[model samples]
Target chain A: MKRLLKTVKNNFLSVFFIVYIAVGMVSVCKPQALNIIDGFLQSDRSLSYLIKAPVLKLLDIRYGGVNLEPDIKLKAFYIHLNRLIQRVIGNDYIYDAGPKNDVVRLNNGYLTTCLPKLTD
Target chain B: MLFSSTVFLFAFLPVVIFGYYVIFRKSRLLQNIFLLIMSLIFYAWGEPKFVLVMMLSIIVNWALGLPAAKYRDNKVRARAVIAAAAVFNIGLMFIFKYLIFTLENINSVFGLQIPVPQITLPIGISFFTFQAFSYVIDVYRNDGEMQKNPLNVGLYISFFPQLIAGPIVRYQTVANEIKNRKETLSDFTTGVERFIVGFLKKVMLANTMAVVADAAFDAKDAISPSFAWLGALAYTFQIFFDFAGYSDMGIGLGRMFGFHFLENFDYPYISKSITEFWRRWHISLGTWFRDYVYFPLGGSRVNSKARLVFNLFVVWFLTGVWHGANWTFLVWGLMYFVILTVEKLSGIPKKEGRLLIIPKYIYTMLLVIFGWVIFRAESLGAAGEYFKAMFGFNGGTFISDDTVFYLKNNLVMFVASAVFSLPVAPLLRKKLMSAGERTRRAADAAYTAALLLMFVVAVSYMIKGTYNPFIYFNF
Candidate 1:
């Protein structure tokens, strides 16, 4: 019983630490805690920003300090090469297939930038 | 140079290893001299003037450590010498690393217009400083003998394998190996295997994941919860493989030179708690801080509770600042400190045992994934926005075409990374060892073939000029 008393006496201040942090977090960090969690779970108040986000993102990629135009060009080349492979396979009678996800619309920014235009 | 670079893979490493074995096989002196010169060249290639800085560090630490050894009987003089060594080593890092941070903070706080020094941080300043600290500290503690030769000390500090991004090698750990070590055929073979695995981890897994991570993080579109989660997950794995992979390469390179280095990481992701996570991750750094910093602060032997708090605070605060001179990094370290403190006080919830451990894993991984979100962000505000998007706070669609496309394309790579992040390779090795002799030999042969194939693929990736800078190299 004396030993238990000594142990508790020694750790009395240590035990208070848990309480101190709990109170500090609640008093200082508590207000934003729920709001932060809410931001994560609940939807934001806008439908207009949806399209703007991707455009800004791509802009960041293009002009975000590190130049990656070569990498972007390479990615475009790979996509085109993939389509060519699909077309070659489509020519085989055993693997006749409809074209998909490869229609390079001239109006699209990505396509216009990444592909050679038809020069009639 | 990056291990995954073509110059390193096809040119530098091959030439260095070949010369070490073929040309300098007879004399250990020639090998040491050769390694020292090559390491200096490797460092100088990046920062020509900063190479002199490293040499100065080596000379100063070497000079100081020898005297402390000489005056071991005189306590005060020895202490002062060690103290000077610490100041010089740490002072060098401070000027290069924290000078800009200090000036900016002072300007912001005091409303002063002190021009911040536009010094480019010397490469590997953080890593080498800690490694240098270990040498002086070890000497002070009388734990290791003072190295007599300056070349050996230089080799210990500027050892190329880990000189840049470390599993910070201790002077004491490789003290004997510096002067006298054997380069056996088996060690050489083992080193090749380890290097190949590390190379593949960086080139194949980390680099590919980095592409996905960048795309997701850089997206200006309203982030769906799915996309946010996926990017964060990819980043989490990218960082692990990138750092752990570099450490593996370092250890492998050390072995090839007949200097054995300790393993820097276990599988940290498999950890059940943040406390356990630190135990498993960047093990050398954790141990270094513990031995050099924490223990010296009367770790766990605190006479008072306040003292214990002070000790924990110091260790963790230093831990955070060690990563970078950013408030976010400081907060990241504090975040761990708070959780670790809480866990230490309240103790983690029960059911920590193996049976029904799945929930623990889920809890741990979710926290880790969240932590990575904070660590990878440009600022706290950006991190805040990201957190919201992760939980679908932003009024955005739960799915995007980009997400679906990336998921479909990179699903195989993701699955492979998930498998590799665990101990699948180690498990396979365990099974092979327990099998019969013929089975073990077959497994070894197949493993050799696999490493060779990975080497070829990694070399191709290097030739293609993938973004191959190690993430931790910035620190």
Candidate 2:
């Protein structure tokens, strides 16, 4: 009991400092993660299509076009970040599909593909 | 120069803090001078031309106040001086804020071909003018002595922190503090903590919600009923956090400068009725109006029923006009007046027990949300459309992808905002302080660390450029 009390008493400030550092690190890292995710969302077609599907489904309730869940955007953001990390470490995780429905292509053609699909 | 701006956090604040401590740490007079210069620069940074207007108002009020101070028994002259000062201050505010509205109304009503003149409304004109106006009135009323030092009076009028968006510090409230106040270590620490909490609220929560609210509000036609409700709810939270965050920062900064300004917001969301809400929310402005305007107009003391109603109308009208130049603001004020009048007539039932808390909260929240729709909408038509959408009149779906997207992206932040908006810190401190020495020590350590973490994150957000101006700066 004494030992446990000692641990709690002695390490309290240290534990707090660790949490502080972790929070600071996360704060610093979040924007970089967001930027990378944005890039991936811009590049991959299948991923983009998979993400937009749910959003498009949701958009049908509105004027039948504005489907895009904040969560899906966040997912796209994370996926993009993962891809970015892979790129930075020189791992080619982003597969280049030649000319057919890539995430990049799908994303760029989102208005045409998603809007029509929702209306139809 | 806004408290939430990146330039303010990184450049302006740091420099001001350093300069203040380094130059005027020991001397109160020197500190006041330094603050005045900094405040002048801050105001001039936004509106250089309006600085002259502020100066003119200050000089006029100071001059008016001086005569009233000297003539102790001359009631007629004292009344005249007060009247002149009030007219000039209110007149300037009217011309700048409401001239365009007046012109448009005239053109529509009488077929007058009056061209709307382009006039830039000075930020915080209403606030500073009210402070100046209050000072002169107080002097005439002999509630407080007139400030002998013009610079101190100038500082009171233009104190940058609360000048733009205010707790509307009455001249009398800070009169003694202006002449004599000491900055203590404890006060400084508390001030820093308060500032950090406010900063976190604005950057982490309010701004995030603002993005969704702005987008949904702008694209109203495409918005679902659920989306519209979400947007309104988001805006309700957003404006509270934004304005309350500003008031916190202002009060915190006031403390840092060894001044104790009045609390602007209590747990206003916890209020049960519109009357209770007014008492809690914008307490400073409400008190100022009550003391300066309402009581002087005979308040509820007048014998005739018509006179009492007329008094309420005048107070509400001026209160509405004080908020902004728009007819919407006027309508919003009148709406409150009508509701309060109704509440007064049909008396609120006596609270039976704690079980009523939930219903009361819901009641207040609903009223506040409707009020905010009026506040947020560009015009009455848009407000009506938005209100209709909220009720699903357009047969819109319950949940949209955009709605989910906003929720998902901001979920953590929204949760954090909810938790912090309560008096959690103060409550925890109170509990710990009463428990034992060890617990108190632990609480202090935790609080300090949390403050430091918040500061770093707030700075990071500012650096990343997500900072937004406080919502009430335009008032």
True contacts preserved, each candidate? 0.00, 0.00
Candidate 1 residue-wise lDDT, A1-120, digit = tens: 998777544443322322432332343333334444554456563544554454554345335642222233443443445444323323111110111112332323233222232111
Global Cα lDDT for candidate 1? 0.74
User: Tens digit of lDDT per residue, candidate 2, span B1-475?
Assistant: 6776534554456557767777778788898899988998789867678999988888888888898787757988877787788789889988898899899999999999988999998999989999999888888777777888888889889998889888799988888888788776557655766776777778657876786678678883657787787788788888888888888888888877788998998877777888888888888999998998889899888888677777788888888888887877888899888877777656663455688878877887898888888888888888888888888776757788777766765666667667766677678778887998988877777767777655655544443333365678778
Off by over 4 Å in 1: A1-120, B349-351, B354-356
Lowest lDDT 10-mer window, candidate 2 chain B?
Answer: B458-467
| TM-score (0 to 1) of chain B for each candidate | 0.97, 0.96
Best candidate (score: lDDT): 1
Residue B385 CA displacement from its true place in model 1, Å:
1.3
Q: Which residues of candidate 2, in runs, are more than 4 Å off?
A: A1-120, B349-351
Backbone clashes in model 2, listed as residue pairs = A37-A80, A43-A104, A44-A103, A44-A104, A45-A102, A45-A103, A45-A104, A46-A103, A69-B405, A70-B405
| DockQ for candidate 1, C-alpha atoms | 0.01
* A107 Cα displacement, candidate 2 (Å): 12
